[model samples]
Target: MPHNPISNVQHDVMHSLYMNHHNWLYTWIRRRLDNQFDAADLTQDTFLRIHAKQNVDLINEPKAYLATIAKGLVSHFYRRKSLEQTYLEYLAKQPENLAPSTENQFIILQTLEAIDALLNTLPGHVKEVFLMSQLEGKKYQQIADEMTLSLATVKRYMKQAYVHCFVLMENDFFE
Candidate 1:
């Protein structure tokens, strides 16, 4: 292959950034998380996220940039952990014979994560309306009553949410 000066410069900058800040980032994440293992994993994830952007050369304050990425990751880690804990607790309450197999449990958890991600993309009111109708089995009128929204507004929000989900699924299918 040909020598690429730009690639080499980016590589060197990334290497320097990682070498200078890896320890500090790890310690910072470790301070927020109880598990050392999770802290380590998230620190690596933070670096991977930055690498994906291919903008290491643009970062002027390396530590601040790293901390910002790490903070978002830490929030995501806790949210996923909380979701898993809730699922496990629900499973624990199920009759032993009714419990899902480990493989199914994993699949269900992944589906939940995907669903959560999709919902996060929707506008707040739309998500709330959709969740009320789908998850809580509430009627449009009931949702309207509870939220102080008109029935027509509730229906509009639900339509918006459904269209958002459909567009995302269509994109995924094509991809």
Candidate 2:
């Protein structure tokens, strides 16, 4: 079967992209991380993501493409770190006998991370309302009163949030 240049030369294109952009990407992430070791690791991770995602068979703006992917990796790294710290603080607050065992703690932490990732994509107000109602166990009226939003507005926000989450589930965001 014959294919166009785009499909035929994908490997060459990817190699060229890697050669041209990998060093710059590494330096960029390194500067942000302020630690050479972590920077190197994340740089490799960035490329791995591109390869796995197959987003680099064509490179129009190599630097911009690499930077965007690397930036996402950096953001995820920070988000995961914050989730870890929050989880540790939660464990600390629990009485010693009541806290989960070490293995269970890891499971709970991963669960929290998955939930956080799901919520992170929602709009600010939608996310706030969702969290207040779900995590804080607040009533819709209480949420409306606390945020100075009308009851109707609160209902709309909750509906929007729930719909967004349902869509994500349908689209396999959980996977």
Candidate 3:
């Protein structure tokens, strides 16, 4: 195959960025996480995320760009860890006979992650209202009173949340 000059240029930029900043990025992540293994993994993930974007040439401040991406990855890593810990704690409290098998537990965790991702897509107020109604079983009037929102506003937020979820579900189904 013929060499593509644009692709080669992008590759060169990425290589230069990695060579110049990989160690610094790794150390920065390591300081935040205090875990060499996770730091190394997230550092590589950071590079991979940048590469996937195909915008290496546009970065003016390599360190700042990389730090922003790494920060998000670290946040996600902690969130996932917290979710797993919570699930494990819940499992520990379950009766032995009622506990799910390992495979089932894995499936349940994946489902929970999917649900979390879906909820995260909603606006903060919408998500809070939906959770209060669905998870906490709060009435619309009660939620409105507690949140200082009108009852109609609470109902609208719930409607928005349900529609958002339904659209996402439909897209997933089609995909």
Best by lDDT: 3
Model 1 C-alpha lDDT per residue in residues 1-175, reported as the tens digit of each score: 8989988888899999999999999999999997899999999999999888888899999999999999999998888888899999999999999999999999999888888888988989999999999989999999999999999999899989989899999889323
RMSD (Cα, Å) of model 1: 1.9
Cα lDDT, model 2, residue 173: 81
Candidate 3 per-residue lDDT, tens place, 3-91, comes to 99999999999999999999999999999999999999999999999999998999999999999999999998888888899999999
TM-score of each: 0.91, 0.82, 0.90
Task: Give the lDDT of residue 72 in candidate 2.
Answer: 88
What's the TM for model 3?
A: 0.90
CA deviation > 4 Å runs, candidate 3: 173-175
Where in model 2 is the C-alpha error above 4 Å? 1-8, 55-57, 170-172
RMSD of each: 1.9, 3.2, 1.9
Question: Model 1: residues >4 Å from true position, as ranges?
Answer: 1-3, 173-175
For candidate 3, what's the RMSD?
1.9
Clashing pairs in 1: none
Instruction: Please give the distance, in angstroms, between residue 42's alpha carbon in candidate 2 and its true position after superposition.
Output: 1.8
C-alpha lDDT (0 to 100) for residue 125 of candidate 3: 97
